[model samples]
Target: MGNAYYKLNKIAESIYYYEKALLLAPNDQEIKTNLSYAQNMTWTL
Candidate 1:
């Protein structure tokens, strides 16, 4: 879900969904990586 948004160049939405997912599974490395990526992309934008 968040990955899809990120690929679509919707960083804000991607981060939103990723944060929501993280709340559910704080230990998920994949989600953490994706959230980090999305955040980095947002900063770069």
Candidate 2:
């Protein structure tokens, strides 16, 4: 779901979903990495 939002260029939504996912699996490296990507996107914007 997060990835879908990311691909759609919905950075806020992607970050929201990624944060939600992180709550469930805090140690998930992929989610962390993806969330980092989304955050970086925000910085670029």
Candidate 3:
């Protein structure tokens, strides 16, 4: 779900979910992807 958001360029949504997910699993792959993608976009998502 969150990964899909990041993949589709919805950096904000991805970041939101990734942050929440981080509470449970900080090393999540999808979260990493979202963070990286957001970083690349320079949106701080």
Candidate 4:
């Protein structure tokens, strides 16, 4: 899962999973939020 990858500090994997999840539930706020968080992490890196 995205959250699991995020917690493990695997940003790319997290983003990948989150994007896949978004495809299934495009309007999901939680997935959007998590994806945003993962993306922001990339920016910080």
Candidate 5:
């Protein structure tokens, strides 16, 4: 769900929901991937 948003270029909202998801599933791989990608987006900007 959240991953879709990031891939759609909705960075701020994606990061918001990703942060929420991380709190619930710290070991989630998809979340990690999204986070890594989002962080890279941050660095790029």
Candidate 6:
């Protein structure tokens, strides 16, 4: 879901979905990394 949003260039939505996923799996490093990437994308944009 987050990836879909990212592909669509919806960074805020991507971040929203990633954060929700993180809440469900706080220990998941992959999700954390994805969320960080999305956040960085927002900053770069």
TM-score for each model: 0.91, 0.95, 0.58, 0.94, 0.70, 0.93
Flag regions of model 3 displaced more than 4 Å: 27-33, 43-45
Identify the runs in model 6 with alpha carbons over 4 angstroms from their true place: none
Error of 5 at 2 (Å): 2.1
lDDT of 6 by residue, 1-45 (tens): 999999999999999999999999999999999999999997788
What's the distance in Å from true for residue 31, model 5?
0.6
lDDT score, residue 24, model 3? 88
Q: Which stretches of candidate 5 lie over 4 Å from their true place?
A: none
Best by lDDT: 2
lDDT of 5 by residue, 1-45 (tens): 567888788877788888889999999998988887886797676
Model 5 score (lDDT): 0.82
lDDT of each: 0.92, 0.98, 0.73, 0.96, 0.82, 0.95
Q: Any idea what lDDT model 1 has?
A: 0.92
The positional error of residue 16 in candidate 2, measured at the CA in angstroms, is 0.1
Sorting all predicted structures by lDDT, with the top scorer first, yields: 2, 4, 6, 1, 5, 3
| Number of the candidate with higher TM-score, 2 or 5 | 2
The segments of candidate 2 whose C-alpha lies over 4 angstroms from its true place after superposition are none
Report the Cα lDDT for residue 5, model 1.
90
Clashing pairs in 6: none
Query: What is the per-residue lDDT of model 2 for residues 1-45, given as tens digits with 9 covering 90 to 100?
Result: 999999999999999999999999999999999999999999889
Indicate the residue-level lDDT of 24 in model 4: 100
Which pairs of residues collide in model 5?
Answer: none
Task: Give per-candidate clash totals.
Answer: 0, 0, 0, 0, 0, 0
Model 3 global lDDT (CA atoms, 0 to 1) = 0.73
Best-performing candidate as measured by TM-score:
2
